[model samples]
Target: MQVTQNIKAPEMLIDYYKAIEDSSARMLEAAKHHDWDEVVRCEGACAVLIEQLRYRSQDQELPPEQRKEKTRIMQRILRNDAQIRILAEPWLAQFDHPFEGKPQVLH
Candidate 1:
């Protein structure tokens, strides 16, 4: 017989936060390696996870203990994002004038 385990709502919400933190870490790693493509992929993953977290959070509230852990996870994610932005600054500067001489069209 196969058994399945059901996670509680608060736990599930923490899991989403952990997943997002993980994806943000990966994005930072990719940025450090100058792998913009992988960074973008990880960023997309983080976006999806964020959306899922928002949806799951609609009716779920974490308990005090889990809230502390979520705060830690959020802090890590923010740190990773800060590092990634620093790493990407040079690469992003390349697009500073991408449309400098292009004509603008209003729709």
Candidate 2:
């Protein structure tokens, strides 16, 4: 979608937040596979992409109705990114540190 110069930062921030999860997934996967190189590469890529979205994304945002979508874009993206990060963390941890102890059910 094309954005005008007036686009809001919050709206763009949502997308930037979202890309975090996508990037984290790649990081987690690479870690899972013992591909530390790939993990590092993905982290760099993700950082750049997020920076671009946060810093370079621009569009004209005007009219409440027109701005709604961008607003929603930001909200939804941020939410997704957070959830994905939550899930990815444990997965990444498991990959990074293996336990030789007997598995115990927490619940």
Candidate 3:
């Protein structure tokens, strides 16, 4: 089999992108309605999905400074979330990408 066969199809990847866009839209909806809780929930869910999307680094070897940066990020991977969504909301909105889901509480 060719290596490309194991790779994800472009549309599947685009759907994932659209899901994220919809997720952002959901946040925008929540914000428009002044629903901070829903904003927090939707943004956090999208962040979790992005983390899951990361593939293993092909370049396993890193220079010393880069290694330290990677170590810091890896350490954060274990830390409990500390209400990061609050800070994240305005910043994400400033980027102006459209997301599309009707706002609803998932948990």
Candidate 4:
């Protein structure tokens, strides 16, 4: 017999925040390894989670305890993002002017 596992969607706004925090952490890890593709993939996941969070937030509010947790999650996510940016600056600089000294017009 084969068994299937069901995954559940986050039911609270704070849950979405947690998911975004998780994605940011993954992105930071990928940046540490210089895995640009994985970083981009995790970033996409964060974007989707952020959009979902915005929609759900319109109808739901976090409890006091969850709000405190959400604040912590947001702080951690921000720190991860800052580190990722620091790691990416050099990598991103390479594309700043790929056509330097090349002809302005192709012919």
Ranking by lDDT, best first? 4, 1, 2, 3
lDDT of candidate 2 at residue 81, scale 0 to 100: 48
lDDT of model number 4: 0.83
Instruction: List model 2 lDDT by residue over 8-38, tens digit each.
Output: 2335454554455566655656555656666
lDDT of 3 by residue, 1-107 (tens): 11111122223333333444455656655656666677677677667545544432232334455555545544443231233355456767856855445475678
**Candidate closest to the true structure, highest TM-score:** 4
What lDDT tens digits, residue by residue, belong to model 4 across residues 13-89?
88888788888888888899898888888888889889998999888888887878888899999999999999999
**Which order, best to worst by TM-score?**
4, 1, 3, 2
Comparing 2 with 3 on lDDT, the higher-scoring candidate is 2
Alpha-carbon RMSD to native, per candidate:
8.1, 10.7, 14.6, 5.7
Candidate 1 deviant stretches above 4 angstroms: 1-11, 99-107
lDDT of 1: 0.80
Regions more than 4 Å wrong, model 4:
1-8, 101-105
Name the runs in model 3 displaced over 4 angstroms. 1-11, 56-107
